[model samples]
Target chain A: MATKILIVDDSKLARMSVSKLLTSLRPDWTRFEAASADEAIILTGREHPDVILLDFNMPGTSGLELAAQLRQSHPHIPVAVISANIQVEIVERAQEAGATFLAKPLTSPALAAFLDEAQARLSVTRPSVR
Target chain B: MNEFLEQFLIESRELIAQATDDLLALEHAPKDAARLDSAFRAFHTLKGAAGIMDFDAMGLVTHATEDVLSTLRAGDRAVTPKLVNNCLACLDQITAWLVAMEESEALPEEADADAAGLIARLIPSPRPEQPAPVPAANPGEPTLPAHAAAILQEQIEVLALPQDEGTPGRTAAAMRVMQNIFTRFGLSAPAAPTEPATEDTARPQRMDMARIETLVNLAGELIVVKNAYGHAVSLAPSPALTKLQAQLDRLTADMLRGVLAARVLPLRHVFQRFPRLVREMAASLDKPVRLVTEGDATEADKRIVETLFEPLLHVLRNAVDHGIEPPGQRAAAGKPSPAIIRLSAARQSDEVVIEIADDGRGIDPAAIRATAAKRNLATPEALAAMPEPELLELIFAPGFSTAGAVTNISGRGVGMDAVRAAITQLGGRVTLHSTLGTGTTIRFHLPFTIMLTRVLTVEAGGQAFGIPFEAVVETQQFNRKDIAAFGAAEAIIWRGKTVPLISLAATLNLPDTPPAGIIHTVIVEHGGEWGAIRVDRFGDQLELMLKPLDGLLSGMQGIAGTALLGDGRVLIVLELNEVLK
Candidate 1:
């Protein structure tokens, strides 16, 4: 089956962007979308999605902390944070929390290429990632 | 600020000042309906003003603020200090916008965040439902007024679309007809009702912020390319062979000027907020200070005016807080109880001179000396020997204060140093003169803008170097006959007492020493003293575009920034005073 991924963001524009990017980058991939952390976690438990892309500045728990929680709950799944509030400390904290970070406003080409490389590596190391 | 946003900044500043004054007056009477009405009017005017300026982004934010003010004015709520403070915070964000606009016509990080906060506060918080509608006031106005924002935005958009081009026309016209009806009632036009229209609304076309930054970066890169090409032409065999080469050079220079002019903003934008600021400060302190301004009509290189705002504000604040004593104190000193602060500007030769002066309690030389002693800043001997101007200048010194205790307003050490640093960064000079209890005047003479600077080129250690021409006090020839040595340090008696002298070559650690002949000495003054710099050769000065040194290269002492000579030779512009320090 196609690689399954989850996208989470509170902003309609941001969520739509990540959804469009994932669908266009990997047409064969299955994508699930959620607006908040609680939804992402519930969906993660249900679908066991390979990779989760998170937003940082949501109303409730930020994307980085949510990714950290997901890592603790589902140790095998890899979480990535995509955010616009890119400060030096936030980048450092994201790295320490064990999630790959992508700065926003993400260019489509860069997002597309990043997914291609990431999916290939996941297929080799963790077939369960996708 | 760009011409448009600058117009926005100035008008908003005036509204804020008027609003602050009216609110403060209300505080005295507490039941003055007329005063409250005027205050409400100020907010409404500011909202409408923001719309008129086509600064819809900020107008919407102000519009939301106006809603809360309008609601409160209807006897729905009372004005408190907390509300005033929120309004002040909103003013501050707008102030930040001026600064950002000065540098780039961009907002400072989330230009819209404050507006959102202000709007959120205006919409009464969810509480145990009251019979009517009202809410608790907060510490600051939202950076924006979201309530009026939608209405103002639609109005501005309609206005901005140009009278002829505003019709969204066929398909989309029918689409937004419902939104147009809903939004006319001062409601937020929802992003989209369905997915299909949502896609259309998502496509925004008015040059994105990234695109503006990219344009600037490309322009900057083009200059680099132009300079490199010129360098190649200079090195080519038969350099003067054809008119094509010179024509290409002139064309490139013209293009660079055009690019720079694209960013040229008027000084009135930077000055616009000050008149209101002066009025507010005068009203707050009850000092009756009138702001007399000149040169509001002069044009400045845009970036220069932008950076000038903070330092100028800091100086103006000091004038209001400490420079002008209270009415009783001023009268006691035989000066006018109502102090007049004059902010005047003029183009002196090629530089712009801005003077902020007040006729009140000037920088007291005795107080400065005492403060210097308390801070243990200057030696007893140094204090005794220093000139009055030098003593008055001590206010800018780090950690030196004359105040007996720290007040939120004046005793802070950031007063003059920040001003000096900012002006110096823009290749400028600031000088101060004060009469004991009479008054003080601080003049900042700066290049009309950033980018180009006039510099003195001097040769030392077989290398050519540049330093800001303003740093040079005078240049003279020094022989053993003209100079005499003092203990440990050398000195030259110019007026009476000997001034300290240092060999520039020795100071900068250059290889070339003064030849057996008479050495050319350049006297540069920094802070409040003069020092002589020795050089092997001094050449004609140059006006060149200086490229700022990277943080790594910036830490190098005695160097300000670097500039490339027309021949492509890189030279360092020295800050002589920094070296002496």
Candidate 2:
């Protein structure tokens, strides 16, 4: 099955930029965009994306809160909390919320590395939730 | 700008606008947890955007603003007028940074300094505790054993303190504990005092506002000089001079167009400050006034936008101080506890009209008439005969005070009259419309561009005068066949409607007698009244630069400014608004 991904951010540019990069790298993958955490949840319920790329800070629901909720509701899907703020506290919160962390202003090399690792994990028959 | 930077600028500006609205909403409803949360999110998103764009200075400021909003959400701080104002100031600084970013694609040199000052104010007061001193890692000291490192990592995992991925050492342990201590002491460790990556030089260069203004002003002067040169070319009649004049004219026009494009700024530059102003004004006066701003995207000349600040302040102050009743009175009247003052702007043809309307008790015509009569400023019969609007007009009369006593809030020395004068000086007009028990709307009609104007030059009182074509309905000859006498005013029947007529020579105190036969007349409108102003003769329509009259000529009632004609004569630019009024 083709890998499905969901990208959530309040900034349209940020989401488009990441989506464009991901499509250029992996042509077969399907991508979904959501402007808020609420929309992300709705999209997840409808589409069942295998991996989620969420911005740490959003207007209504923060990434940590959404991640925690998603961990409870969608245990099979993996999540990555991306942020430009690499503050130590935020990183810890993301970990506690059961999401992997990714730094932003996502250069091609960094994104490629993260995607390769994610694909490897996906190929091994969906890793169990921590 | 590259596509990436362009996108960044666009997104950052929109976020700033949303953040401003969120800040004002929080101020309006302090208990509305949703507003506070949204505000925090806005700043947080902006910080992230700034970070991706390499605008560290802006990110720093937004980070601080976010922290303050976080504190408010946590109930560590109350939402006060001062706090809202501080947030507004932070946004203003961010706006300045955006301006710089547009010009240089990087924050200005003072970005760090400005962010530091605002962050100092934004960060909540530090907890009162003496921090344990951090021990510097000495190279000579032995590193922690593998067993000891493992034990330390276990403790960190249990405590949930962030773990550095590198293998643990005694030095790393010390550093982690120090960071933990700072976090526990409720302080952000004055991070990024060392400057972040500097401005990327590869980005497209942006011009600053001052430089743009300088270019615009220089271009305006060149147009004036070109007119004078065209006069010289006509007088001297040389082929070379004529050719040079044409080239110079084209160059000046192009330069002016280019510079003026840069000088056009949105009305939000001025409108953004009103939320904070009204909020503070309400708090100080013990009256609840909610400010609603609209049409912030309406664009106007930069100079006009700057000059709008004072007059807007005066009108808003009046709305808050004298217009809106106290909360108790409003509640008794079955009105909303907090009155709404709407400040809106829109482009109307060649003019931008800004209206400040309040939902409060409107001006009392009786009080105005009584005040006029008691002050002996006007006779009782005149005051009684005047219409309600005319009665309200008395408020703009110098020394007219309808307020029972002067208060520090608005009515001290300057009244609505001063507001009228200030706006008038900018070649704009102010008028008041009120309905008793309803509200008042003070409207200002200002020219869209102050640099250049399309005017019809007319010979009035044997002197050249320029009248803005926007205000002119049409021109016709004043014939004896259609003339009639109306009390002390001259009237003419045009299209079967009686129109009042005023001789420009007489109104301007020029030495010219009214002609008996046909005379040149231009019909103009001001404040809903249309009238024909008779002049000696009509001249050519010219696009001219209007240099405001200074010194002795500055205070002239009807003259807006002066421009140079191609014939080498100075043309007095008539403020048609004032002349018609």
Candidate 3:
């Protein structure tokens, strides 16, 4: 019952090194960080979770207006972004808004192929918020 | 998460000792509205507890230390000491990545993207880190020791035992207080102590303050080799080189100020988080406070008791948000609906006072002379001829609030200009007083160590400055026809007071010219005004070393940092809070 995950950054050491690399890939994910995009829209208004990572530049707000305010108030919170300023129209604007990209100094096999294709596109859509 | 990363490394070491006593109380009282509201609530509670402990490299280095403490909390930049030692080395690299994740169970989070590329070089977008030959080191050990060799070059490994089964009563009460500090330092306590992650590198190697500043530079090079063996025993030399340089400079400056008084600490780590911030600001304002504290063992200088803990937690959260009271207005002002405060600490002369006080509803000086007569900042006949300690020092100005509203845990005034720029960058001074319904101290003082001062020695445009001794106030030798000419500017008039002059070639834009006549001045002062300056001479008083003004002439103005003197040269000092702006 873990997979919570959010991890946006403004870096407290890259959010404690991707929260100690997802707590060392332990009891499977829980992390969280949002220092801006008004705290990932107040942490997806306190719930919308199951994968986010994000970070594309911070300061006032901008993770692409927090991925268009999490695609209009949490479009089933997908996001992945992550960055080290890798451009290509920022992965073609996070693949034209439908999120999921990685390019950063981030390792662990590019965060395990972004949690294996965002857990097969969240088990075909929302799958109980993973 | 390891008790929220040990309460966010004891609240980012009390917001890096409230940004090093608000950059040493804004270097002796700069535009202090209570040290820029305690460096904007210690970088807004260390960027809101490093964004609720995900620690994104200490929440993007405290969100660029809350945009340089909200640009010195809206007075738009001034609190310097190199931006309080680069937000105290980004709270010593988030306390060396929380003591490398409490001694490695692993979490140097691979030095969190090289500590967010050294906190995006303190904020100036277009990212990258190449500039490591200087500035806050650690890019690849450019002279490391900061975070003491990044927490003694991390290799720690001990996170395996405590599954919390009475964690062996917290590792046998931290091994009986490290065997009572190793048998009170004489060492002998290892009788039967062998198991619990014992030899994985004892890195918290205590004896701190940079090992008591290398035993105060080997007790000042053994009192300069006992004053060069009392000048070679007044030339009568050989009493075996004057009793071996007076017994090796009296047992090395009494064993280096007795092991630098074991890195003096006490003031209970500066009153350990003010009784949990006065029981969470008197149970979130239903009021009924208490607090107390007093000297809490009163020692000093472990970097000034870790920077008088967040400017005495924003003077006990402005004595529980605007001096206590609440519970039915302290029983309709007859008092006792619950309030107390106090807080204390001692040591004076070469400083460390502290205070805090409170009781309830005190400060009012007509709500700081009607918020400095509604921000025109005094004029209703100068707020009716000011004085009541200048109307309780206009409740430390800035955006002075009496707090009828706006507050999450402190009125909107912003913790008295960060407790007067963290006790004026620690050469210190805060003062307040109050009194109305009666009760409110404030105080502060500081200098147990921003590390030495005194200064004076002059010279001006042909360089060499230093100044300091509380910005001087007297220097003399004028008459190049009493220095007048006010077009390209340069006034003087001295005694009956006329002041505003500049000269070391119009304050260092330099081209030379002073030696052609007999003109000297110096003056300095600040709160009331006095500049005089015009130098070209006066050099006697010595003691230098302050440093901090480099990132290549920090965009020069009237210089305020650079010191190396003990007969070497490089002196430059002046920044009396950017020459009182």
lDDT of 3: 0.62
Candidate 1: residue B20 lDDT (0-100):
56
What are the interface RMSDs of all the models? 14.5, 2.0, 8.1
> Residue B532 of candidate 2: its Cα lDDT?
87
For model 1 chain B, the run of ten residues with the poorest summed lDDT: B195-204
The candidates, ranked best first by TM-score, are 2, 1, 3
lDDT of 1 by residue, B37-105 (tens): 667656654554444344554666666666666666777867775565455445544544444444555
Model 2, global lDDT: 0.75
TM-score of each: 0.53, 0.60, 0.30
For each prediction in turn, the share of the native Cα contacts (below 8 Å between chains A and B) that it retains comes to 0.00, 0.48, 0.00
Question: How many residue pairs in model 2 have overlapping backbones?
Answer: 1
lDDT score of residue A130 within candidate 2: 13
Residue-wise C-alpha lDDT for candidate 3, range B133-214, written one tens digit per residue: 2243345423422332232233222223545553443343334333333332234444322222211111222325576778
Q: lDDT of each model, Cα atoms only? A: 0.65, 0.75, 0.62
Clashes of 1: 20
